[model samples]
Target: MAAELMRETWSGEVSVVTIGAAKSEGGTRSAMVKIGGQKTLPFLFAEGAIPHKPVIALEIWDIAPLDWPEESTKPYGQSIKDPLAWAQMCVKEFKAQLLCVRLQGAHPDFGNKSAQQEAEFIKALLKKVDVPLIIKGCGDDEKDNQVLAVCAEAAKGERCLIGSAVQDNYKTLVAAVLADGHNIIAESPIDINIAKQLNILISDMGLPLERIVIDPTIGALGYGLEYAYSIMERARLAALSGDKTVASPFICFIGQEAWRAKEAKVGSADQGIMWEVVTACALIQAGGDILVMRHPKAVEKVNKYIEELFIPR
Candidate 1:
């Protein structure tokens, strides 16, 4: 008799969430992307169904990014000064499937810009790109609530994903997302229990589980990347074992964390780009459903890797 293939069966699956609404759906986006709905680990086709392939979202800033290394900003050229132009370049020039607007300028310590300023900037970006948008706040909890609240209203009905709602400061952001008909990103430190707890808290506030994406916090290749990887692996395993609280899709800020490491920022051309590529590829294999990246070259390389992994043989 011929040897037979053995596969482990899973009882749970990731929830499917759709971002962006078309004109008929009450928003102006021309396209939308669906993530999650995986019945197995990332790209484990032989074991279970991978209903949707992972997606790559390019990060654009409302204000010009002054701290980015040259290797990461070279592709944008002159468009870096203008948010609209920069976002358009990402979609039209780099072939980005989704765009994430990081409202770094709203931080009091950064630009001290008011919430309305960031909201208007986001409004302009929505008109410039038809792809889905993810609105992220600066790391400051207080400022994030202020800026993201207005942003949620500005992008109302567009079904954008807004967040980074942490354990302590999720209420305001969660309420804004719920009121605007947008989705929320539940962020937790690299702890599986905390990750699940945050999701539960958001769900308790009445946001559907499907509308939430878990950001378990990322660590760059040499900077505790293994810890991040292990956390994600455990989360996915629990989800597959019928744990609904941790079953939401995972999003990793690959570029942000990767470039934060010295190896990716202060190295020669080869080292700088290679670090980001390796970091992103590792996260993908570790089961990241949505990756927010900065460098276009890194994005392109990761896109190619995803194509190879997702295509049917």
Candidate 2:
């Protein structure tokens, strides 16, 4: 007799959040990316529906990244000096499906750009790229509160995914995102409980649970990746088990974490690329919906890897 096959079923689905709006939706994006709405674990199609594939977002800064190693900067060349050109290169040359604009220049230590300046930058970027966007703020809470709110309003109706609402400072961004018709990213310090709490807090402010993405603050390989993966795995399992508050899609900042590792900077360019590729691949399997990455070569390899994973068995 043939052995019986066992398939696990879940009682809940991850919230499906769509980024960007096309002409039909009253925005200028040529295409929109939809994430989440999974009924099972990542890539277990036989078990349940996996609706949308994980998306890869290339990171571009408002100002030139001063600390990036040569391997990371060589991809864009002169485009790095101009955020608009950098975004264009990612889309045109790298074929990036999504773009993440990091307003690092608005940070106090970076350039202290006013909220108005950041808002203008977001406006210019929208005119330059037609793909969905993920706008992230610099780490300064005070400055982020000022800048992200303005940027959120500036990109109104565009349906961008703007982050990040942390436990300590979420209300401003949450309110802005809610008012602007954009999704919000809830970030936690790699703690599952905190992640859940922040999500609930953001939702409490009138933003639907479906419009929120979770950022568990993952670490790169060799830098506590195992612990980060464990947290994400647990979160996914909880969501599958019917935990609504934690059922949001996960967005892992893969490049930001991957490039910071000492190994990526100390080795050959190939080594750095591999570090990013491996980090991204691991997180996606752990149920990451959006991966914000750097380095076109790394993104290229990871895109091929995603294609291979999605191939029917």
Candidate 3:
């Protein structure tokens, strides 16, 4: 008799989350996209159904990213000078499933913009694009709470994903999202236990697991990325294996890390040739559900790899 192939079976429940609010469903966007309606492990299409496919958001900065490598950013040319035009191009050209406008420059020293200025831009953004909007803050605990609250209200009833809710300021930000009736991303710094803990804390505020997305923090390729990868993998595995509190879908800032790493930033055949390509592909394979990427080229390339891997024969 021939030996039989063995496979593990899981008898546990998994959570499915729909991130964006559709227009007919009551938002400005024509449609909404959610990443995790998976009933099995990532990319296990044959094992169970994946109700919502992975969605990619093109990242735009409220201010030009001073840190991005010129080579990595050259494609956008001078369009980075205007957030509105850049956003228009991202939707009309590259086909962004969603748009994330980072208010990184809204800091007084950065953009010298007021809360009013930030809200103006956000309201302008909602008017400019019909895609489900994700409004992110500049990672400041106190400032983000104030700014994001104003922002959530500005995009009120759009049901956008409004957040950057951290442990330090989750209460303030969470209150804002609830008040505005928006979904949010609860960002924790790459610790599985901490991620779960934050989830519980936010859940305690009465936001269902379905209403929030988890950011586990990505480490760039060849830059301590393995630890980030392992944490995400384990988190997914634990979720599939019956960790109810942690079963919310995961998000990774792939482009942010890709460019943050030395290799992806380099512009030479000797240093950066194919590095972004290699790194982005690996993250997708490592249980990353939503990848926030920068370059159009990398997004197109890695998306192909994802299709080949995630879709069943």
Candidate 4:
């Protein structure tokens, strides 16, 4: 006798969120990126539908990175000196579907760029690149609150994904994104409960759950990758099993985490790129919707891998 295949059914779906607005949508972006709207686990086409393929975003900074080692810096050459040039290089050369711009210069220890400066910088970046953007603030809580607010207003109606409202310091950024008609990134410190709670906190501020993306604070290949993967997998399971509070797409910072691994540093240039590529693939398997990465080679390879996994479903 022949046996029948058994599959688990999901009761809830991941909410769909659209990034960037085009000329038709009252914004300048020439294209938009849509993530989420999954009814099953990652790539289980036989079980359910995966409406969107995971997108890889190249990471650029408002200021040229001072600490990146030679292996990573050699790719962009002098374009890294200017954020506009760097972004254009990523879009035109690498074909990045999205860009993650870090306002690192706004940190007090960095350059201490004023709120207005950051705002203008964002406005200029929007003009230079036509792809959707994910605007991240410098990791200073008080400073981020001030800087992201102004930057959010500067890009109002563009529908960028402005982020990173944490448990203790989320009110300002939440209000900023809500007021500007953009989405917010809810960040938690690698804790599932904290991740869920932060999403609730952000949504309670009058922003709908669909407009929030969860950043579950990921780690690199050798550094707590399993732990972070477990957290993400658990969250995905909960979302599939009818949990709406945590049913949001995930955005993982692959470049920032992968390059920091000692193994990536203690090896050849190819090893470093492979480290990033492997980390990115693993996360996508575990259910990552938006991956913010560096290294053009790594991005090139991962784009191929995504094509392989996404079987036109």
- lDDT agreement with native, every candidate: 0.91, 0.93, 0.77, 0.92
Candidate 1: residue 30 lDDT (0-100): 90
Better of 2 and 3 by TM-score: 2
lDDT of 4 by residue, 1-313 (tens): 8999889899988999999999898899988899999999999899888999999999999999997767887789999998999999999988988999999999999999999999999999998999999999999999999999999999999999988989999999999999999998999999999999998888888999999999998898888888889999999999999999999999999999988888878767688899899999999998999999999999999999999997564
TM-score of each: 0.97, 0.98, 0.93, 0.98
Kindly list the per-residue Cα lDDT of model 1 for residues 78-135, writing each as its tens digit: 9998889999999999998899889989887779889988888888888888999999
Q: Would you give me the overall lDDT of model 2?
A: 0.93
TM-score of 4: 0.98
- By the lDDT metric, which is better: model 2 or model 3? 2
Prediction RMSDs, each to the true structure: 1.1, 0.8, 1.9, 1.0
- What are the runs in model 2 whose C-alpha is more than 4 Å off? none
Which runs in model 4 stand beyond 4 Å of their true positions?
none
Q: Return the candidate ranking by TM-score, descending.
A: 2, 4, 1, 3
* Model 3, position 240: C-alpha lDDT score: 74
lDDT of 4 at 155: 95
Error of 1 at 119 (Å): 1.1
lDDT of 3 by residue, 38-137 (tens): 6676676667676776667788998888887776667788888888988988888888888888899876667656677899999898888888888888
